[model samples]
Target: MSYGWLDDDTTISTDLKTTKETPFYEPIVNNFETGGYNPSVSYHYNPDVTQYHYGVRHPMKPFRLMLTDHLVIAYKLYEQMDIYKPRRATKEELLEFHSDDYVKFLETVTPENATKLAQTLKKFNIGDDCPVFDGMYDYCQIYAGASLDASRKLISGMSDIAINWSGGLHHAKKHEPSGFCYVNDIVLSILDLLRVHPRVLYIDIDLHHGDGVQEAFYLTDRVMTVSFHKYNGEFFPGTGNHDETGLSKGKHFTLNVPLQDGIDDESYTRLFKSIMEPVIANFKPTAIVQQCGADSLGCDRLGCFNLNIKAHGECVKFIKSFGIPMLVVGGGGYTPRNVSRLWCYETGIMTNMKLNHKLPDELPFRNFFQPDYSLHPNLGDRLDNKNTKKYLENLKNQLLENLRYMKGAPSVAMQEIPPDLQNLTTDEEQAIIDKLNSESSYDEYLENERYWINEKDQARKHELVE
Candidate 1:
């Protein structure tokens, strides 16, 4: 069997007999019929993260996580990946990136005492965007913990890719919260990766800028953050701009692709590949952390981009082909229904399972997907594509020019691989060990790197030969 580049339909063929190695390329052509999937993808989720309510009027809903999980189960996508209910993040773990004062405040603050602590709330930027709700502290721990566990799995060589749909709260700062995010789980997870990997790459596809994450690693070349978001004007937490690269040692490291409104799938993907291909080559990061925010999809309540579910997922498919250890997390999505659909679809993408378009009858909240009970619904054209070809060409040139400044992928002096933290393994540790022994090692998998060296040569060449 042989696999080629992604086409319009996003189909690719691969040798079915190849050992289950990286979670990226090997495709189970008919997983639904065979009940098989790549076992290297570990899914870290806790049901408790879905139980918390952010407030009645607030757009950020934890219930969407529940919906996404239900959809994954209903589609039998869980059969493809190892699932674990990760532990809540300890205060010590949170302190790795968050300040002691802020960590203590998140632990102690509650709605009952919020009125009296108005001044404290103001200081932390937790007014309307980041409100004090019941179980808010516990909720933050659960999500942050899932992300930490996901990153740990990648670092320990236990999983090729780990995902936490409840994480990716990228708007939270070191000492304050912003844009409905209370904890910067992405930042915390990246810090964890830096312990083992010399360099880490962060790519954010949220409709809003990943300001909190960009700011956290702006001064260090150890982590390179690339955020593609709707920029300019009065966008909330507006910071991502083409000119706002990085500072000091990290001058050319942080790359921001500031897009205009109503960018469609073709244009969005073109720019994504154009910029990402070179960035990945030049940075040569060992691990990657991608924030797959569903708010960027078309018809989202707050998002202005005109991307469909398939288009949004194309980014994940392209990235996975690189065969890098990755941690995927959730971010700013207002339409809970679409958010659930987008994430569930992406989960299938990660596990290399081709999902059925029709929603399963047994899926919970089935009625919520009314009118058309399909995974990829027609969100219709709500906004015109403001991004012209000329504008995109020029923007691509500017970003590529900046890459020329970098001498090459920064080299790190060889050091001893850090010992794994002294944490007890979960109940399924033995089963995981058995699976790891049966699969290919990390070095062997990287040796078989299936990369598209040139975007122009392999753009839409799709075929799954068998």
Candidate 2:
């Protein structure tokens, strides 16, 4: 079964003609440069995050986070990054993005009392798609906390990149759950980023559309959400269309690279770079939040794309090349074994560590990678590529046309950051940051201006010294 428009060379030709005739704006040069490549990465994890069970028959599984963690340890990739058992996200943090009603519902409702709260569950859309499992509220806190902690680390100039495999619940809404997502961790983390970052770019490579996060920042110009996903024929979260650009102040900020089933590695990467390069050049986001959903890989139980693990990871590598402070989080991936493989591989990429093809002999879930036991197993093509060259070119042209509306990166005047949301570092952590600043000539103090960390004081101190 294939999707996407059938071969329409004539329409493609006409579209190309109109695009070329339309006077395109000169490319905007991106100025938000990273001082230098700092591979100081932080990894957030908590075993309890992977302990909750969605349901016996449900496709969503929390155990995949454990599998991913075990592989990272087995490959010794954990040694390359600073690891922290994240604290559970408080109701206050959840309130930053989710509604108070939704937060209270998740905090109170559980499997034992779910029957009593049937009416409430229905109101919040917490049925089959998002089941009220044991310790469900706790699960949400753990994952959401990790992403918040990860964002704090970036905002404090303590890490260049942060990873939280349990985060990236992109489909969760402001007052409801959707598509197996209970909390919009991605949105919360991006909200944290916006406290200091002038502009943030959110990129989701999940098989399904990142509707919840898109909706959260749909009306804002400060955060640009770009989602690339399979969008055809009543797909899950039927959004992310060609013409579904942003509204009013957010015009042309929301970019959707809708794809068809069975897109190959070369084609996916080519299209990704083509659209992202121009978008980044124009948007010039100070920070990036990427949702790496492994379900987009080949053989994923619920996915239709034929992308292999490598192709999926290529997106991470491409984003990393930009050298922007980033937070990488996981999203949908049903096949547990492959999810572990894909995320573990991406973790290595973020840490700049090259992992071997063979699965570690000491891997805890060794049996999962059965038969071949290879890290990059051949996930043979199960669907034909319906995204033809012409179709992709048309998408690129359309997206580029949209980008032409932005004269340049919109300026964001400094705002008074809420004191509660500010990054507060401990004395011990401050010592490490001070030592790094003294040793490296990267001017960590100047960089802190970009993060707006103690901005007024830092500016005053520099002025006095001058």
Candidate 3:
């Protein structure tokens, strides 16, 4: 179902009506100049046209105000980084991962078709989970293009790190749509990288498993898929069992760490450091893709975890610590306001920008919810819990065990198998051929891959002079 938070017309005006008497409406925008703002400081809030009468019925609306407020805070911080720029993704780039047919379908979907498509929601998997709104395709393309832009920036070497807070719709598949995702931008971006790099590492931190991406590359060793998410049982779209490793040459390439709910920052960090860090280091990938889904946060509507904002920030920090080219994307976050702020704060940290403490005075729908510093407050005040510490220690032990196992593990190099001379069955022979083909393509693939490497060189040159 389309969460009501996605409504475009719900603006700061709604928020003001609900919490006008509270201290939350204190204006904090007097100190900053609108002229210094980054054009990329996009605000998704739009005022509702219908005037509200006294005692008029309204849906649960405070969450949207929270998102807009957080975004205003984030945008103020983003200004310090000077990294907001829009870039387009080329057709060849999009086709790298997506089917030509699907790409064409996305381009052709119109408002009329959207209505008909909505009627047959099951056919397209576009009802409540992923509603076919008026501009759904356009929104998908914007995120898809933004992801492509981030990938291009990395490939070009313009910046070692980049983030598209709007991207990370990871549930979309090659031929079908699932969840709220219409396009698997992460997969497409990875496909774009395969053209330039021999090995790419993908990490998904969304509370839900990155099943769509895992399915796409289940048989390829060139891409290492690592996902850490909640897996209690049949939680949204299922899949992502630990045993669901890659097939053939890709068998051990996929790693699924199913975490329990209520995992706090310390435990989450320990899991990353102990398990993901070493695995990535050993793999020695040229690039990394991270989906920093905000749903993992404590107060998310759909999430069961208890992680605060600092915990989310730590995930970004940990990934960026690798010093490899990294692209950060946004994923699930039902508590739009909180998650947006979380991401905004993350972007600031990643870009080496100073974090701003203030928010806009008058926000769209500012009155919708009373801002009790206790209920939906800032992360600066929350303290780490004891459970977080214990979880970390447990994760450390797991990592130690894994490292010991790896010490006695076989070499990563593939063993050459001679062609079968005996008349083996065609199907059996084809399987072997497929494995060899995937392995052999790695070398020649990287050589001819044309990425935005030159553009990155130019951007870096420009940054140096500036």
Top candidate, metric TM-score: 1
Q: Candidate 3's residue-wise lDDT over 15-109, tens digit each?
A: 65544443322222322432222212222221220121111222212233345335545245434333444544545556667678766766666
Off by over 4 Å in 3: 1-75, 79-93, 109-111, 114-123, 354-466
Worst 10 residues of 3 by lDDT: 46-55
RMSD of each: 14.1, 14.5, 15.6
Q: What is the lDDT, from 0 to 100, of the residue 291 in candidate 3? A: 91
Residues 1-466, model 2: lDDT tens digits: 3422212233344465554443211112234463345468999998988778888999998899999999988877766789999899988888988899898998888788889987897899977788888888888999999999999999988899999999999999999999999899999999888878999999999999999999988888899999999998589898999787888898878988899999988999989988888888899999999999999998999999989888889888888888899999999999999999999998878876666677756689799899988788877478999999999999899989988987789999886954444335577667878898786756765676557655555685346422
Candidate 1 is scored at a TM of: 0.83
Worst 10 residues of 1 by lDDT: 17-26
- Residue 418 in candidate 3 has what lDDT? 29
Question: How does residue 250 of candidate 2 score in lDDT?
Answer: 87
Which residue runs of candidate 2 sit more than 4 Å off their true CA positions? Answer: 1-38, 418-466
- Cα lDDT computed for each candidate against the true fold: 0.86, 0.86, 0.62
Candidate 2 Cα deviation (angstroms), residue 373: 0.7
